[model samples]
Target: MKKIGLAWQIFIGLVLGIAVGAIFFGSPQVATYLQPIGDIFLNLIKMIVVPIVISSIIVAVAGVGDIKQLGKIGGKTILYFEIITTLAIIVGLVAANLFQPGAGIEMDKLNKTDINSYVDTAENQESHSMVDTFVNIVPTNPIAAIAEGDMLAIIFFALVFGLGISAIGEKGKPVLAFFQGTADAMFYVTNQIMKFAPFGVFALIGVTVSKFGIESLIPLGKLVFSVYGTMLFFIIVVLGSVAKLVGFNIFTLIKTLKEELILAYSTASSETVLPKIMEKMENLGVPKHIASFVIPTGYSFNLDGSTLYQALAAVFIAQMYGIEMSIADQVSLMLVLMVTSKGIAGVPGVSFVVLLATLGTVGIPVEGLAFIAGIDRILDMARTAVNVVGNSLAAIVIAKWEGKFQRNSKPKSQTTEILNVN
Candidate 1:
């Protein structure tokens, strides 16, 4: 563990975890005994989520001087996210159609879940339409939104508060500075938390492997491999191209962000590694303003992994039902995904939810949800890491595009380091 990289350590933990699970998968006693370890890891990550989110948003927002610019950034952010998410979904649909993953596979033999219980909840989740999507953009109660972990609502409130700080002229300077100081304090706190990352990831993966086992993955390796391969291809080809265009190296970006990705991977939630991500971006020379606005907002709008998952999973389902979607219909499916993916940021287990919400547009069976449900958790781990990559890249891209990005985070960095020293 000390000789090699943490990534290797994590790989070992994953292998061992799988071994442990396979050893005891059918044994209730062992499974029950091992359950608490996973639960503790999940809860520890979750415990930080609300505080990290609120503190980060408040600080990130306070850095934004003009709330009016919120409209411009908000507009551009949404537009860019929708376009990419749509493309991602299109990629998934096209790949599934070409690959035909579900072709000749017997769905009748595959497990079907009673998503009926989730159906009512899913139906009330989110739908695609201009008015509904637009109306829900602003939060009615920012505090309630934060407590509920509503990404969009929290974003709305932060934008407003940050802009307010900017608008209050000389009077707001103290208030803005106060929030900035608070944000700085939180960044220090997050950095300290991140030092324990490798162990946390190991524990999380260990418990997960122990619970699910390697044999469970045996039957579903096809789906997992396909999704993992697809994500890797896009991250390299597509995201690499985007990084190149901006004069950044995707490999370096990956290396720098690996710890955050691991955190997200082990926890299976993009928000899980958000604090570390924010700290890294700010340290890597992305301005605090851009990091603050784009990262959190990107969490909501620019979900490359979730978007990719939706497209791939949807097409896989249609193939299971032997449904042939037309060229025009396929394009429409991408369009719906592009729009629907934007509204799902605050949602827990949003990938499945978004897939269910939008699959109707592509003419796939919603019952197909169950067929993929067993595998969704694992799939989410891979893509949530990708989503972090996508959004972090977006922070740079949007900053470059708008020319508001500050590559200097020295003041913030020094403050953070000094706090850690103490």
Candidate 2:
């Protein structure tokens, strides 16, 4: 008998999880049993992320062997990230306004979770200015950055280290080979770890459903609907237009990333799919250098989905409290979001952190977030998928802009055969 593909296996796991979770809804035992499986899978993914990022970036930059070329790519990458993410914020704001998701809601009836943790995080985040964010990107100690999983600082160190290797001519060959080997080995390890994704997806979804039964979504369904619908609109209309201009079909790209999209949505974590995304982009004909540099940097700077949700959620919280925000007020909120949303993607509960930090400035109640915190996971899953799509597309756009995209090329062969689930 032919074996099942990974995507099908993951889908099966998702369906099974939902069914089991519904049956066991509100059972504490679900988390007690399933959380460990999910945590292990997540830990496995995290374990590989730092090494893959560092090695892949170092090899990519050194391979470019020209600071000018690297600079050009970096500039174009950041510019594209800024434009796309700004458009995402605008799209989100428009969606929230048009949908009126927060209207007609009785706040007292909804289950409000305590948001003090996110608020505390937001308070800390507010102390750091954009100038400080830029300054902190240059790691005072690269090892600490890696140990703490500080992506921006790690990326900075890798870029400079890679450049140093390139500058040394023949002497750099040994170092380059070492990183190239490391990148290759990490990809192999990623493939191996991916074999556990079905179990991870199953356990993670099971825990979510059990903890927050599907019925809990009814009270806040409008907000959930608005967020999901708006993300679809942004991806299909905004990012689709972008794909066309860059000479690729958005639908085709989606088809190409079906597995990654499903996995991202199921887990609600983009980091889980980071390694696969980079590998697949290279297979899709983006040069390794551009894919490596653009995708990881995009994680820090190009969070399209998170920015969109932050804008919509800020407006959402204001509306929830019956507070009126005029065009000027919303535009101000957008401006604040544009500044505060940057460099906080690594923070836990990042969407809430952004909203907490921005809402007070725009006259939205910081407490309003508590009203929707119960269903934030449902909203987060959708946005996480969009973030993955947006970042993947960024790699293609940068490659195209540099006149290096190879549309007609075939994907590289995998070193190991993917496991077949029977």
Candidate 3:
């Protein structure tokens, strides 16, 4: 008998999870039984992320070995990320205005969750200036940054270290070889870990569904619907246009990344698929250097999904509170979101933190977040999928811009390797 594909296995897990969750809706037993399985799976993914990022980036940059070329690629990558993410913000704002998801909702009827933790996080995040953020990206201790899983600092150190290796000429060969070996080994481990993804998806979704239940969604249905619908719009219309301009089909890209997208959505954490996305993008003809550098950096700087949700959620809270936002007020909200949304992707409750930081500036009550906190996970899952897609596409766009994209250029061996993993 032919083996089942990973995507189909994951889909089966998702469907089964929903069924079980619906059957045991609101049962604490679901959490007791399933949360550990899910946590273990997530922890396994986390274990490999930093190493994969560091090694892959070091190898990619060192392979290029030309500061001028690296700079050009970096510049083009950031520019593309900024343009696309800004478009995401604009699309979100426009969708919120048109949909008015929160308008006329009876606030008292909505279930509220404690948002004090996110508020505190927002306050701390707000205390830092842009200068501080950039400064912090240069690690005082690279080892400590890696220990803390500080992605920006780690990226900075890796880039410099890789360049150092390249600068030393033939002496760098040993170090580069070590990182290349580490990257390959970690990818092998990633494939092994992915074998457990269906179980992870089932447990994670089971917990979420049991906790929230289908009924919990009914009260905030409009907000949830609007968020999902707007994200779909952004992915298709905004990201699609970008893909077309770059001489690729968006649907094909999505199909190529279906497994990653599903895992991201189910887990509601893009980190789960980072290694796989980098691997797949390289297979799809994005150079290893471009894919490695752009995808990880995009995690921090180019969060198209999170930024869009922040824009939409900020206005959403304002609407829920019946606050009249003038055109200038909305524009200010947009600007604040554009600034505040950066460098906060991996933070727990990040969307809420961003909204808390942003809402106060626009006169939206921070407490308004309590109204939507209950449904945030449902919203988060969709956004995470979009983020994975956006970042994967970023690597491709940068590769194309650098005149390096080789369409359908995946070697037969690599194709076989991916199939074997699946």
Evaluate all candidate structures by whole-model CA lDDT and list the values in order: 0.71, 0.88, 0.87
Clashes of 1: 0
Candidate 1 clash pair list: none
RMSD of each: 3.8, 4.4, 3.7
Candidate 2 lDDT for residue 338 = 78
TM-score of each: 0.88, 0.96, 0.96
Q: Deviation in angstroms for 256 in model 2?
A: 1.0
Model 1 regions lying over 4 Å from their true place: 1-12, 57-61, 68-70, 126-128, 404-422
Q: Pick the candidate with the highest lDDT.
A: 2
TM-score for predicted model 3 compared with the true structure:
0.96
Pull out the clashing pairs in model 2: none
Q: Is candidate 1 or candidate 2 better by TM-score?
A: 2
